[model samples]
Target chain A: MLSPGIMGRSLLDKVWDLHTVRELPSGQTQLFIGLHLIHEVTSPQAFAALRDAGGAAAGPPGHHAGGAAAGPLGHKAGLRVRRPDRTFATVDHIIPTDSQARPLGDALAEEMLQHLERNCAEHGIAFFGPGSGKQGIVHVIGPELGLTQPGMTIACGDSHTSTHGAFGAVAFGIGTSQVRDVLATQCLAMARPRVRRIDVAGKLSPGVYAKDVILAIIRRLGVKGGIGYAYEYGGPVIDAMTLEERMTVCNMSIEGGARCGYINPDEATFAYLRGREFAPQGEAFERAVQWWRGIASDPDAVYDDRIELDGARLAPTVTFGITPGQSVGVDEPIPSPADVPADERAGIEEALAFMALEPGKPITGTPIDVAFIGSCTNGRISDLREAARVAQLGTVAPGVRTFVVPGSQEVQRQAEAEGLPAVFRAAGFDWREPGCSMCLAMNPDKLRGRELCASTSNRNFKGRQGSPTGRTLLMSPAMVAAAAIRGHVVDVREEL
Target chain B: MSSEAKVERVEGRGCVLRGDDIDTDRIIPARFLRCVTFDGIGAHAFEDDRLQAKGNHALDDPRFAGASILLVGRNFGCGSSREHAPQALWRFGFQAFVGESFAEIFFGNCVAMGLPCVTLPRAELTRLMDSVDLDPQQRLVLDLASGTITSKLGTQAIAMPDGARRQLLEGAWDATAVLLAGGDAIDATADSLPYVRGFAA
Candidate 1:
């Protein structure tokens, strides 16, 4: 094993060095951001901040006397997007999936969307609004459009911006003020985090998924364990995962308290990016692959720490608490406060009380009132297909309301063309339009009072599904499908 | 935009919220984030948690109602990068934070807003929280230059990354101005990366 602080440089260091604009006086890096994705919910305040400050693109002018001729310099009259070509906007968090109509039912949502539209138009950035056939969760459409390429530094106001790290990018979620910084300067003042290599080897058990793999990792590492570190996932299991599967794992990196997580770019990554809307064409793509391959971490790369897990032993996982870390195998029992150490017992007791769950009781057979199968975490075509396969097995249980929302308009279009929506409808699931429907529940899709939902979204935080007292159990889409059919939290393996 | 805007010191009464991983959802629920602006968000800080506790929660308690310094447990802002969490807290009158630790994004958000979030050891934070609870009106002072938090109870050293400390002390925490000052370097770096030009470069 290589010693820490040795010669080997990890992929993060390579990308960090490449993106370095300069080191700031504050001892932080002023790193250039390559791509910026924005959504309606978190961007209004950011744009408002920029405008209020009278900030211009790429600084207050005169910073660069003879910079690139095309740079947006000396536009001090108003706040403009510094790199409009690299910035993309979409309306997701507050958009209703049931209807894409203007004058949205929620007046505030309509106002927020209009602000985004006006901001994008005013700044010359691309706005993938409703009916654009390009709108979806910012994270979802970025990869689908091939905009989230490897070796890039992507930023968004949304916390799940880490989802882009699946392509080997050094992407991290930023706050609204940081979002304003990215728009005005095309750079961020950031302190780099140490990298931890989380290796999961061996084949996954049947019905176990990328979602389960991440859940198990969070379960072992605790939610805040990854703080001050970026997680680099590898091993044979990660090597074999499709890009979408890798995305699902990376999407919830925030749930584990890691601001960013990534997998090295490999053949699967290059293959997925080839010929996509924003990816390089023919010969350039081959060159891009060569560059991407060289950016992967060296074999002897040194890491701050390492953790190993066996994928084969992992079972279908579900969160029974307010946090993603408080999870158990579907067939496992909810943790009793007595079984936990005194310091940890309070968190478990609090979660159990808020979730209205009985300690020491099995999580399976816990009745659910709603089943949600969507989010940036698992709303892609592949996830929908997996759920649809299970949907064919049985009708949704009586009194259970189930929803299967695609991640993007593209995902929705592809699934519709493949007849997957009909399959979900036939099984008593409501097929909705794309947006971050019910994930954070900014839209109309929300859980009613005390309702328990088997969800495929990332966070299981209290009130995450839009009801102050609503309960969410984070699981994979197929598991959600099985639960919707049984009206309870059942292992998908059993139904299969 | 000015060096005078730097947050060198914060001195005021302290409010304590005891819990680890007290997430952003619990701080300011998503429903309150629908507004186009962050105005009037102070009324909703810990909105649900306060409602659930029914005046028993720290934010709702009369003693802590006007507190300016917040002392919290480890991982105090663990989920979601919604700046609304800190915005709500800031609007609710919190000027400085002392905790065992804070989640990465939340810490960055607080820093960007010119709010200093310093950390102490678990025992020290517990002692500090207890001190504030015992005397709710006691004023605590945090000096970023000295890296110490002091009160009538005593004084304890706090820790934060040197970079963040410098940023806070120099009033460079609102990073847009600093980042914009590097426009030439930014363009040069972007030009050097092959991927920036779609590998055609």
Candidate 2:
């Protein structure tokens, strides 16, 4: 890497610089938003806010989609927004994972979905409604359709939007107000975060997946440690990961208290985006690939802070507490409060009580009532293949409820194509369709009273899996599969 | 930079909530996230836990009821990117907060919503919380312009980032204003993007 004063720049800097429209008097940059990905949960209030401000959604400056007449451009009408093409909506977070049936059983969920659908329609924006074959978790489908690209600034109302940064884009999770800002102006006013380069070198051991890698990082850096910084994940391990694997790592950057985490674009990135649905075509595609590769950090780029880690020494890990920071290797014993920092003692106590676990007990045999393997973090094809491989090795433990929810219809289709769904079903796991699923548990799939679940989804906070008293342990999909086989949290290292 | 009327001060009873790393999950549970609008979310703030604990949770305690100023421990609102957390607190009648520290997202969300989250040193934070705890009726005043929090017991200067403090004091945290102010440039930028095209193209 470059010395502190060297001029070589990273992709994060280039993307940020390219997107900087102007610096406002408030010292926040007026950053042009290249992409706005919305979902059922966060866009309704924003759209309503737009309309309340006496502004209508405007199409691209001089153009209209679907013959919908364009409104006054930008924020001209006290609250106008331009560029419908830049905004895309998908029905996720609150959609039913079991079926595409209309008017879902949950009235609130159905209402949110309807609002999202209507808002997108009235705005002349694209909506990937359920059964459209494109509807899925917003993060999953963005990259699936090649909407996420290098050198762009992407914003989503959900925290996992950092997943898009795997393409070398500068992406962030904004609150509802900021979502409205992007909708009304195609830009956001925000201070830039310092860059923290986290280097996880050495090759990953078998069964120690990207989920483990990210979890390990979050464990090393306290959940709040990344505050005010953008994480630039690099080193041999990151470079060796596939596009989807990289997405998994970047997906939980928010869990680390970092707004965004990114990997430098390389041959691997362009190869994944090549010929995909929204990716450039023919000569255009080649030209785009060149631009993508060029955005990679120079060999001698600098960072505000650097952390080094070794991936090869890691084991399949699982969270034993509420926050993602309380993770430990599957083979390790649950840590006692005494073993933790004084600041974290209370959290450990609370988590141990909430999860109904003792401090010194090993998590390996910690009984689990459910196994949920899905979320933007790990519901992609490679994640499914790893889980499926383990499913083929054993059957779901008796009385254990196992659900394999795909991240998207596209992922579901690919999983089915590879016969992974059959493998899951044969092992007594309910192979379900797409959406956020039990990750956030807005849909039908949820935990019952005080049930402990091994989940591949992020965030194991109390009630995160739907039941207020239910417990969740965050782990890799393969670990979840192994847990399903054993009826408890287990090490995928041996099972795989 | 903003057309919003500047805020100079706020005065109210103080409600103390002591706990570090009290995350958004405790602030507003996910099950309550289904509304098209954030209405009545305050009632459900700390929903499940409030119910489970026989109504002893901070948001449920009668001591903090209807109190507009909240005093909390370190790392308050540390999980999830849900704006509902602040919306719930806003609906719960909390106008300002004094804390040891705050999660970046929660702090940013509060500032954007015209809610001030000012930090105090740990010793001073304890004094603030203790004073609030000693008398639920204790009145506190937050002067945004002066960066001071005054209570019947004492007065202390709060530490806030200059950027956030400016917005809070100016009432300029209204992002809509900034967004609208840049309308022409925003439109021009949109016009230049290849992906941003008229359907007719």
Candidate 3:
């Protein structure tokens, strides 16, 4: 039985307590899910398995309907497919943000997009397609449309689904099989992760945006720092940030090894939700706000572990090596192999060789072949507006290919209405439509061999940009804009 | 079923390639991620620029031909949480991966699929890679029993940490073994606790 103190409480506690199907012997809470988001990339197999089970269940009358159906339900009866209303679909990858026309350039990509559309339609599930102005990167579209809100538990096939945590929701990414499970059943039996508070104090520097702050956190905590933990970002810096900025920080929580990152719902959060597409309205909105407020952690709420950092001390950061954690401040020198710890020396050497970079060299003068300002991490209108501020002041350098992809069609329309695209195009950037372009190189956007790019997206892993040897220098949107104009890695703070 | 089922085991001298922050996309590109099965992904593993040079194809280069054990630098398999990476490596006939470190999800995926991801110091991996470069046929025995990978030049013991060694040794990929291990306790708990269903019909 659940205790009253733990049940029917704050949004986090309510969702957490309600989802506790059981406690495993490993001391992990087997929490259930309320909703699951699926994309084309990860759903093929899980759908196959479900179809297979459905077929097997349709064979004999009693055997199929009773005992065998139970077999397909797994050991837990609570883990059966229930509500399709709570499930949703979206096509983000493989769809060219620039063009929403049918018959995508890549045939297989087109087939997959069509297949997802058909699947969602046949199942009576809602799908946001390319033609849908509301369609965008799954993560970007969810919160903007108010489909994702406080107290809801959201799971997506993509890892960055943790971005929903910005709304005080418990969201994380799962595999395709888990996606299938959620599709068939509105609930997912998952182990609960310990919570850690990443409290950032002080103020942020002018040129340093959310991307730099996240990169700085990953650098300090290492790539595996948040293993098996949910990071709750709190304190002065987060409280002072806007909802979009908070989403940007929580978006890369997975990069630092945390399952999810979140900020407690506040007035800024409620205000952002107000008048949105799916957010509650009138009396219901007020009720929702009151509940959301109650979910904010109590004054003495305890955390399993806590880490604090001075946000003002953070600089315009860029990833020097392959991983997000392998980074340095914009003004800092590339780490020499000798200066690296004994365990990390090999990595430094390999990164230097793969990137063709000299150790102890300044990162500022390093040339770049491309500059991409897009993806769920920093493709919002605010991010574009900031990048455009830089683009309006200077023209892109010759021989540098730059792209400014908006996060969604709405953001695209908003940016164009504000003439942000004109500014970018005038500065030599190709203003593209909204989708996860060049982020993981799922679409047509990719880097050529040995090409180095200053990117606003998350993850600088080797070959993460499509070409195995293509180097990614992760930086803020402004820094990417600066690099695009200078055709090299330049500090945005200098321009500022 | 016979007690002695045909289990194919490939053994080789582990060649350690050490580098930091090797992500899943580097292990297997997103292009190869759409496949439903793990078949033939091994050949395309590291298909991007790693196997190719500027204006040249890496497959034509004989240096990487028949290289089994891939020694990688720190934070190996860091990026996306795609299980396709290990599947691709397995299909490519890589018996084991020796790294200084691994991303958590990638490490878990490898263990679930019965792939041995052994972690060692950066120095040891560098020395192992150097030895492999010197002598391609150098014998490196990966003893699954002891969880130790030994090269004729040197020996370094690696840790699996999560008792994943047993799963690899048994060649079981499904979560059934874990559930079976806890079956007794689960049954006892289920017997004592009343079932309370909570979803709306």
Worst 10 residues of 2 chain A by lDDT: A59-68
Q: Write the per-residue lDDT of candidate 2 for residues A1-496, one digit (tens) a residue.
A: 5456668887788777767777776677888999999988777788887776642333234432101233643333334345687889898888887777988988888888888877787778998888699988999999999999887899988888999999998998888888888887788878888999999989998888999999999999988788888999999999999999999999999888886899998889989988888878777777776667777887777788999999889998899888898888888899999998786788788888888888888988999999999899999999999899999998999999988989999998999899998899988999987989998877788999999999999898888888988989999988999999988777788776
DockQ of the candidate models in sequence: 0.71, 0.45, 0.20
lDDT by residue (B1-201, candidate 1, tens digit) is 343488899999999998888999989999999998889998999988888888889887788878899999888898889999999999999998899989999999999988999999988888888888899988899999999999876889999999999998888887877887785778889999997876884
Candidate 3 per-residue lDDT, tens place, A249-315, comes to: 9999989988778889999999998989777777777877776777677656667888999998999
Best by TM-score: 1
Kindly list the per-residue Cα lDDT of model 1 for residues A1-496, writing each as its tens digit. Answer: 7675677878899999999999999999999999999999888888776666643333445554212232355544445667889999998899998989889999989999889999888778999999798999899999999999999999999889999999999998998999998987788999888999999999998799999999999999998999989999999899989999999999888888897999999999999998899999989999999999999999988899999999999999999999999999988899999988787888999999999999989999999999999899999999999999999999999999988899999999999999999999999999999999998888999999899999999988888898989999999999999999999999899889
DockQ of structure 3: 0.20
- Chain B TM, every candidate: 0.97, 0.87, 0.77
Candidate 3, B1-201: lDDT as tens digits: 111222123367444443456677777888786555455777876676455544243223355456567677666776686767776777766767777777666765665455677777767777777877677677667666766677766567776553455545554333322332332333343232211111111
Q: Each model's TM-score?
A: 0.97, 0.94, 0.82
| Cα deviation of A374, candidate 2, in Å | 0.5
Candidate number of the best lDDT: 1
Interface RMSD measured for model 3 = 6.6
Give the DockQ of candidate 2.
Answer: 0.45
Q: Output the worst ten-in-a-row residue range by lDDT, candidate 1 chain B.
A: B1-10
